[model samples]
Target: MWDSLVLGTKPYKRYYEASLLTRYIPANSTVVTSNTDSEDLRSAVFKTADGEYTILLEAKAGTDKEVTFDFGGEPPVGKTFYKHVYQADVQLEGNAVIPSASGSFSTGAGSSFTDSDIDAEHNVIVYTTLPPQTQVEVTPLEPVVTAGQAQQLAASVIDNTGGVTWSVIGSGNGAVTAEGLYTAPAVDEEKLVAVKASSVQDPDSYGIALIRVQPAPAAGRADIPQFSLEYGKYAFTEALTITTATEGAEIRYTTDGSAPTLSSTLYTGPIFLTTGTKKITAAAFKGGLEPSANVFRLYKIGNVSAGPDGYDFLAYDGAEELSFTGTASIAYGADGLFFYKTLTGPVSTAGLFEDPNPASDDKRYYISTLIQDEEPAVTIYNAGFEMPVTSAYLTGPITNGWAFDYRSGVQKNGSAFAAAVAPQGTQTAFMISRSGITGELIQDINFREGEYELSFRMASRPSYGDILPFQVYFDDQLLGTYQPNPSGSFALVTTEGFTASAGYHTLRFSGIETPQESTVFIDDVRIRPKGSPPLPENPQPNPLPEEPELGPPLEELSNEGFEAPVLAAHRKGPFTESWYFNGYAGVHPNGSAFQPPPAPEGNQTAFLQSVSGGQGLIRQHLEFKEGTYNLTFQAAKRSTSGGRDHSFKVFVDDTQIGSFTTASTAFQPFVTESFTVSAGAHTIRFVGAAATQEATSFIDDVNLNRLDASE
Candidate 1:
């Protein structure tokens, strides 16, 4: 058999073929009586090592012959015989030239097969019944375990009377006991480990389970140190204290601006700031824990100076005692020059600061006693809301020269709601109204008791309209009711001239809420003599909406009532089909925010809101024959608070045909000025505008109809 398979080629194929017979037949098997009926056939039977008989038959090259093998009653009745036939084909190439084998099954006391007219071939038929298969199944196919933890597993054996052996598949993955108990490796990193169970009866049959091992959690670090005094300029001495929140943690500090280290001075008591500026850095440390992040502060002591040109410069460092009224308090220490107020009712809070340096300057008396008289001028410190510089969205009472009431504070420009750039600096003071309660920013100044006007750059929140009107006050008297333009950009507003008493008087900008909530932004506030040249009024208005001329009309705006793009819920988009929307404009179902009024023609309406302080627009293009046309639509304000300032402009092509305000929550019809267009295509656009954030407009049933020549 070996020589026939080798066929003058490498012995690898011969060895492979021999192993197949020895694997199942066994070399010690004994031959038994086996014979074939045809003269051209030969057969022999052998008893396998497993006590079963196997028959081998050989066919000679000749005419087609049907051969039968006689088992002589040795094989059991109803026994299934497995037949394998091997034949050679010259047409095959490479490894394919080797004789190919085919298999089939037959059952009975005797087996018969037909051989076609071809080259001689051998057939091996086995009558032995196969033993039941041995299968091993590992329980918990996948498990998650923590590092250094142990998990117990189980293996079940089926169809065989044998047990299983347990083993690990990867090095350093983990270890497993013979009883299937797995212990995960003690690691700091996560890994996957495979545990396997192999059947002893059938070693080739095995089961595997994967385990995910997670690393242990880490320890926490020490807390950073806190300073007793806020970092800023001061005119007097200060006692500074440094402490940490971590229990039993020691604080190390450096006063020379260098980072604190373990070798730095241990903080035990308060450090005295007698004069000059000092930069302090501190960090906290505890046993067996990482050092905390460093905290730094700069304190300038005795740094107050006289202003040039007979002007007295004054600064509030939050340490001075000031008269505070209502619900207000000054925050000192690390919070740094902040005044806080809590609104419980309709009352307001304020703080008063009198001029500390009201005396005139005199020349050196050694020469000639000469006292110079200069024009009386009072400068408001931190007038631009630039003090307490911070990147935070909102900071407080701003004790650096101003006081706040209720929802009023200093806000970083562009931090909340994508506002326009500040008129003068990176920060602006803001007052908000909620639940009919308004906010105020107050500062007491020692005016020369003359006619004065208040000037400040004011803007409405971009997302909401300027629904809340604000007033300027000289003490308890109102100067004027100022309404911010719907445009989000800041505009220099100068209040009407008002008279003030000579002593210290309060300058307050208070908000007046009209049935809803709103917010106003104030920056660069100044109280100057009435005729003082008004701050150059260079208001930066929001750029006009760009309406690109679209291609000729695509089906004449089929969804005029916004009935298409039907949404199961409210959604924002640049919808398609007949209309195109830019920015925060989309179709909304009736009864939705801003669409409270039933749509004029359908259950849905189109809504638009300002986009990042700019106008939100929706437009459609249509071809028009040279003639006069009238455009009309239904508009309504959003049904929510702060929605009163909603308005929109209608444009035919590039020309603004009309501007309309949606002051009422109910849908109202609006007609644009009749327009004449040349034959061709033109665009109709509705641009939304608001004076405050959260303002929205709803529109529906838009139509453009040609007027009859007779009219």
Candidate 2:
């Protein structure tokens, strides 16, 4: 490699140092020709790993000679090159001697440099064209300054002298002193001023600080208008009222979906809304003060009717196609409304509400009549693969509404090589087939007996031309088998109308194994009535409504009290009957080994112990109706040696909805946020961890119940 040697001592005659070569020429550097024609000089060029070139020149023991050295390529114009000269005439201090003369020169035209005065007799000259590396940072990057106020700023330069020159950018905005003191202009209007600090050593390097200048507060603005009724769909005509908290403010409103101004219609009383959708924009204003910010609300007015066939339909228009009699509650969805009511006969007009806007051919309404405690259609949970927010890929047993088998999980689009962007959301479900094993994702859906169609988006990894084979199945019947085009983009695939009975049916997607491993991405899976409009293309789901009052516990989960396969006092074991346990988690009876409070429901409780810096998790799958429900449980921290506070997380499928931490030795009841599940199977998981090993959390008496109308 690029290394040199020299020998001698005392007067350092003909002395050569190995450290000199290793210091300038790095290991593995290639030695190249310097292209110099001079009998009095010996030269070598080296190319470092970072593409930097270093030149070494030695003048023989003779008269001084001028030499011209050529670099391979032309150096950047005005680029500085450092030069270090070690002369035999200079006195050596110790084993490590400093260079006799050190300076730098900039390239003016070409990459060649001619040294006019090169001392002879054991002279070493090292030349490198590496640019000076410097970083300038300004303190108080963003500061709020009052009009005419001064703020002190500082500049810090790394790898160079700390001296800097401060200057302001905005004209007539502000000024900065040489000492980095910034003063805002004496103006009433708010403005932003940029203060720059340039490095004294490197003029090209600098940092800027933004200063916000605003006038002092004078008076508060009027309060914005508020509506008594919340926005969204309504089944009947409604009266809306606008109000403001500002004492002497006047409310102005607009009904044509335009911004409300001072000259808009004045609000005197409640406004009545009949049919069709309306957008109300309102604002408040008071004399001698600024007008309040405008508030906007959108309301879709529709009508509900009951047909003679015992089915109810909610229509967007006033057209009365069916007779009305019974009272029904309304629920809102992404594209339409659901009229839920009890009926005596089988549903024959369930499809009537499918198309609410006949003129536009928009299917906006749906009828979910309760026939023998069963509804025709239910919502789908996590249908867009948007749960368990992840940045790259996540795989485990807690996928919320979906379960994975083998090499199947959710992944963020564009996170890995060849992964394409999801067609609907930021994440998609991926199934891989490798080693003659097919990866699958399964979800059990509760659908009423009706004709339905299944649809989803599918794509293959980008640049991977292999045909990804996949199949969709409902229960034991295969709906369709597909081999997506290798275009690397998603395409919507829909199955023909299929009949489904009212009960829990396993819906599965399988990536078929082939000679070559393959991967298939699935997103936005949907199942709708045979002819119903496809869920609004790439629709954003509506936020869940406030949970209603819980009526009674639904016997949906097994071993809620952790009493099955009971263990003896002071004993613990993996006795989970209807639940899945991961890490150091299982059921344990109240014992003295780990002092725990009395069981909230039974003699035994589920326990999760953190060990080896790992968290413990317990999860169970349960079926739920399409409504809001409450989840209640009791948790306590185990009193034991090396135990600390326990932290717990609750998840419905892949989304973590709530979490809590417990340090109390006695059991405490905890009611989590309402979980609104579509009528289907969903996984409920609890993950617990503590700072120290052997820390355990005791959980018991977990219950979930659907809320009723009466709070």
Candidate 3:
């Protein structure tokens, strides 16, 4: 022990104590031992006044007190010593025990070593150490290369030596260079290649990268393949087949005149023209090749003959019956016109309006006279069976109790009385064939013991020119066996003075029982009382009367300006007002309502706001008797910006008949389109389809009027 002298006096005797100081010694190059205990000594940490440096110590526990540390790499050239000063967390009882003061040492040539002769304080001691990392990693662990292509590989190395070895693991898979450039096998390879990188200083540490080889694609053209098909008018019964000559190529087609792309429907077999005129487009595509050129073709079909014009009358208000001799009549709400021509013998009616421009067709409608039957009459659900065919391979039960039964002798895609095939003009019609296996359309009627007239229009499939024989039976009794001409023209077949029993009775129209070679199509069936000459009610006597004041032109139209039942004002957000809607969940009942501003010739306009990715609509249910009407409406986009635009699709009773889109910043003139509506209540919906969020649309000024296109 040593102590200072009291009162500034010299120490009684200079006490001597044993002290030890140690530090790391660096070598020209480091060669770490493989022994696991050597690693524990390599974890020693050291610090100097300037900064800190790592030192690896090697010593035997409890047996050796002096520690020797190795700092790999050559020391400074001319420096006499290396100064090291550091505090350390050297011991652990339950927690780490860090030294309060740093230790100091110097290591170099001619370094001094002292034993037992040192200062009483400032004791430096050696503790533990840690091993430095000496490993490398291969980047791009998995790389892809073409079968005959080359790719470069890279490695990241740390500590000891940065140099690495390059090699491939799989035989015949690939070759590698000294610089790590790997070339895939010239032939297509089905396996993967492993390339390795090993550290030169520590041969046991290594890294590996995986290489995958893919087969190269074949060379081919970049355009679509050409298809073969003729363009011309075709009969409704015509079956057309399209073909292509490209090998290993796929053909795609579209029937709606749209451009064909890779996602279009694939064409596999012959196509049968079942409906009206269509624009068929087709293209071909192959792997690694350009799509082929598109081929377009158009076809039109119409009825060969139509029935005579029928008398037209408008029943106004609640009139049960109306008599007229003219060719056309105008009617309003709860009123309609019936067209008919007095028949001297057999009367024929236009089966279906096949002409695309029906506004110019005069023989598409027929009405003999208005007859009010007390009971519900059996009417043909779809006169021409023009409803869409859900599936060609599956049968669909129709409304108003109409169904198709597979007639004998007709094969798959060739069934008699099949739906969707156009037999009358271009409109869809049910097929009826003359086979011994009888197929019939049966309907039960409640007849009040009266003489009734049953009439139906029939046409022969133009593909087959043979005559078709059919029989009509009432209550199991054969009424008549008639042979219809195979001219493709719709001709009326009538059987009158058939006595109907009271209560329910079945009326069966059967196909030919005896085998024949023809098929007939029937449409527009009507059952009513025989017509008679009109009886005059009463004649008024003429007397002197005073002239009345002139009034404004009579209001012959109903709701022509959409100016009834004024709608309330609407703004934005969760619209709630009149007009039915497809629904917006809890946000709004219909997603639109009536707005106050920007009305196109009206006090109010329907406003539709965007609802996420869905559509909004405003619809009205109108009570129309029966008439052909030309329709018109006005629409515009909202003033708000920065959102998707809105469009309109007009539907009548769930069928989309017309549509228009608007993107104007200001309101524009009315857009017009028309469709004929039969007598009944139908819902007309003006839908606003939003392309994105916050898109707004406006609509107003709706009009409907009787159309006299033939005149």
What residue runs in model 2 are displaced by over 4 Å at the alpha carbon? 1-129, 218-285, 290-383, 386-517, 522-711
The clash tally of candidate 3 reads: 26
Q: Give the residue spans of candidate 1 off by over 4 A.
A: 1-376, 395-398, 539-711
**Could you give candidate 1's per-residue lDDT for residues 36-74 as a string of tens digits?**
557676766777656665666666764545554444443
lDDT of each: 0.61, 0.63, 0.45
How do these models rank on lDDT, best leading? Answer: 2, 1, 3
Q: Pull out the clashing pairs in model 2.
A: 6-16, 7-16, 400-653, 400-654
Ten contiguous residues minimizing lDDT sum, candidate 2:
1-10
How big is the RMSD of model 2?
Answer: 29.9
Better by lDDT, candidate 3 or 2: 2
Give the alpha carbon lDDT tens digit for every residue of 452-521 in model 3. 7776666566665355677878877887887656566556666755776655677776777555555656
Better of 1 and 3 by lDDT: 1
Q: For residue 107, give model 3's deviation from the true position in Å.
A: 99
Candidate 1 has its poorest 10 consecutive residues by lDDT at 362-371
lDDT of 2 by residue, 443-562 (tens): 877566788989888888756535569889989899999976688777788898888886668889988778877888888787878887654444432222122232233348888998
